[model samples]
Target: METTQHRVVATGHADWAGTSTQYQYIGPDQNKHAERVSWKGHAEAVRRFITDLLKQKPPALTDLSHLAAVGHRVVHGGDYTTAIQITPDVRSRIEQLRTLAPLHNPPSLETLAAAEAELPNLPHIATFDTAFHSTLPPKAYTYPIPMKWTRDWGIRRFGFHGLSHAYCSNQATNMLDRPRDELRLVICHLGHGCSAAAVQGGRCLDTTMGFTPLDGLMMATRSGSIDPGILEYVQNNHGLSAEQVGHSLNHDSGLLGVSEISGDLRQLEEAANDGHELAQLAIGIYVHRIRQAIGALTVTLGGIDALIFTAGVGENSSGIRRLICSDLECLGLELDTEANTACQPDADIATKSSRGRILVIATREDLTMVREIQAIIDLSSQGPGGVPQVTVSKSNDKLPGISNS
Candidate 1:
């Protein structure tokens, strides 16, 4: 998130594992505050941090009474389409879904408990990463698996990076001065975990990710889509168990496995510059997958209007963007070398004659969460009649309660 003492905001910025806590600082001059603490330890940390900060002269919050509400970012909302206030049943359901996002939701649950204890009077809202993708139609979300599995197991494409995709896609609309529904956009979120989403008319048509976050793009450590037969073959031939296979796929694969070096792309790029073949291959695969995904998404949208890139690699890696956009001219996209090389995000970096826009947008999940939280709060405060009542399903797996503080 943010630097502990400096308040440089890194809220809603998640690592591969969701263990950090970032929130509104109970301090004056609070620009952005972040900490990586979790569980009972995380809860205790929040209580201590808040108590100590509020103890300052003329206190930042004038005690807890000045606080409005608490908002949390969840990584995998399976069914919920929007932000919801936390309740006991809701908290329990979130806990149950931990098996799906073991790395993230556990810490989020801990942080939630901690926040609840520390701020008992406040309403805590859960904003989901999967919330924005609830618009995926059946064809896009459905797996070609058995119908029984689909009906009983809730096995469908549950795309993620919703906050980032929602933020960037809307930003694309704003930058182009067009209404969202009027444009066909492909938003690529390239980070520790990557996914590409197809958004049209402010609705997600399809996304690369599926039942789990691990299903889509090649990430820093996780392998993207692969032949499931490989797992069976490894088990049937080798002595590795299913767990071992899963572990390797999730942790030992992707860039790290291919490059046989660091998972960080910067390191891979350096190695590639030094004539490392595998490093070159890793970069090649990464770019190819992105290009392929963009083409498919463009087709899904009927045509391309803008290809927006956001998140870590998308926002900063000019070379990666250039390589991915190089031969994509067939899709009516063209990268401007000069503009791309020195481009700062929230700007277009496409050639003037390119039929589709090439944009780099710095995603702000924190701001997305804020807007959603504020919307819920505004709805709730409109007296009893203004509050919207909706049912929350404890059905199957769902969002991880990642603490963005």
Candidate 2:
């Protein structure tokens, strides 16, 4: 029997001017191939990329018909608690979430539409980055705002990067040789988009990102948490409208805003090494905010069993990790300076004498999405008695592990 497995992974990014699509596939011989293209339109580019990939007749991926199923990494799923098949209604619901995730959902929808049109016969699944944080308690999710806004606007902390958090949590448990239910962890996902998560018993206790991706730790170009009063103050003083302020915060702020230079951390670090005051200040602010979040989330977990660093910066930048873990002896977390500077992925950089484990794990959100899609498919295929049944309701009352409040 042939044991080789075939799969395709595709991604579409909507940049300032246009869109780009990248696709990868594994052939029957177990060799891998990839291709990328940049074009003007998002949906059209995606369609063209897939069409071109098929024309090349990749070993295992001859065409869209060869795929068993398509799994999409949806940035926001709103109220959905699990991965679901992308039906017409589901697509519409995803479209409705655009306003909440202006930078993410639109590009996702464009790619999704292109894929559906190109491969109508294949089953498509939407695995949400927000779904894993659905386990957050009310205290963690609720904003201390007016009752009218809370009740009428559905405004609350909906954490982002949940897929990365979940993946890191699972990997951390495995690395620690402990059952996930018994471990409490603090996961720092640092990348272009950054956030922290406190996970207890495989469930999210709290996370840094709240309501929107813009509300978390400072990111590459996006400003992290900022005072709402600052917005109003700037509007009154600078004659900037609400929309213009939002644009600046989301695009022109963060490291770029503070450094008055490039947003790339590598660039900032180089400039800082040369005694650039603002560059050094930008790096300091970034490290300071991350360390602060770690302390807060450690308290949220009551104590931490393991501290993990994942994602791009977390996995690669040992200097950044060292900076964030500095002066943490009080929390029983110590980094082995030698191991950290080695820049090895999936390694324990904690000192032998350190009480708490400091680990660096490479995050695989794509694997998480694939597992979720497979789980949904497996559940649907089970016999009537094989899977437990539950009543479905429109009200939030039926959600598990969450209070109606």
Candidate 3:
């Protein structure tokens, strides 16, 4: 079971024609290497990655034949119940769901097209970010909109950040050394985008995000949950088009909109400490919303036995963590101040007596995708009949924790 982990992420997907890609190779047996290279488009990014990977001394892929399949992380999988092999029809369906996730799905489709072109012989697998939230009951997923809209248009709460939530919840259980069925967990994934999920017995009961990614917690530039009337009002009175209104909420809002400074937390934190009033306000709103979501998710889990934080802000920002946990004692989380600031990830920051443990776990969405791909292959091998199985190579990159064999 050999594996190599590499990330090739594109920037400026808003204008896909001119994009820059940042790639990193973190194979266990190989020293970590990362570089930010400019690629004209998604296709170029894929070409550049494949070329560089093959050129590695102990090449991440000395031969394309040894690579079994390419697993993709699709952010929005409208009604997909599980991972699917990217056949022509499946690809078409994924494309159709683009309107549901205009910002995320378009880039994914571009990436998928590029990867398929480069690895024409290998199976391309898509493991969705929404599949994990399929366990959400009707009460949790139903939108209060008209029945025709939901029934005819397929509009419903299809939460995102499922990969992160799934990864973090599993890691939380491992850290607590508790059985999943016995533990109720609230997992917060805070990064450029943020969301919280409530899981019990390995099933997601509810999540902060709704039909789209922008419905839950306020993100770096996205206005989380805003009054629908406000959109109507602006268009009706201000002569703003729907596109303009949508653009403003999605791009100019959240911390950046409030602070009128920057969206990056590090920047906001510094300005806030320097007595920048708007920066302080932005930080305050961010923490308040997260804390509110945590409380709400805790209730969804019946009560939380553990609260897990993952992703950029959740894992590394101690200041944000302290602020969120300050008044959360009612929810049974007691953060150990010293441990909270000094601890590394996969470590608990809770006091011994706290009823609900506070865990900071680094998310491994890639490993999760690999596992999904492996499961699909393994299932297909069990007497056939499913998305056509791809040949499985016994080796590839080192995925530190997952057993690919």
lDDT per residue as tens, model 3, 57-166: 55545455655677777788989978888899988998998777766777677777777888897777888889999999999999989999999988889998887788
List the pairs of residues colliding in candidate 3.
3-397, 3-398, 4-397, 4-398
Give the distance in Å from residue 327's predicted Cα in candidate 1 to where it truly belongs.
1.0
| Leading candidate by TM-score | 3
Flag regions of model 2 displaced more than 4 Å: 1-38, 52-58, 378-405
> Using alpha carbons, what is the TM-score of model 3?
0.88
Each candidate: RMSD: 6.1, 7.7, 6.0
Would you estimate the TM-scores of all the predictions? Answer: 0.85, 0.86, 0.88
**Between candidates 1 and 2, the TM-score winner:** 2
The parts of candidate 1 lying over 4 Å away from their true place are: 1-41, 48-60, 378-405
Question: Whole-model Cα lDDT per candidate?
Answer: 0.75, 0.74, 0.76
Error in Å for residue 9 of model 2: 7.8
lDDT comparison, 1 vs 3, better candidate: 3
* Runs in model 3 lying further than 4 Å from the true structure: 1-29, 32-38, 378-405
TM-score of 2: 0.86
Model 2 Cα lDDT, one tens digit per residue, 170-211: 888888898888898999999877899999999999999888
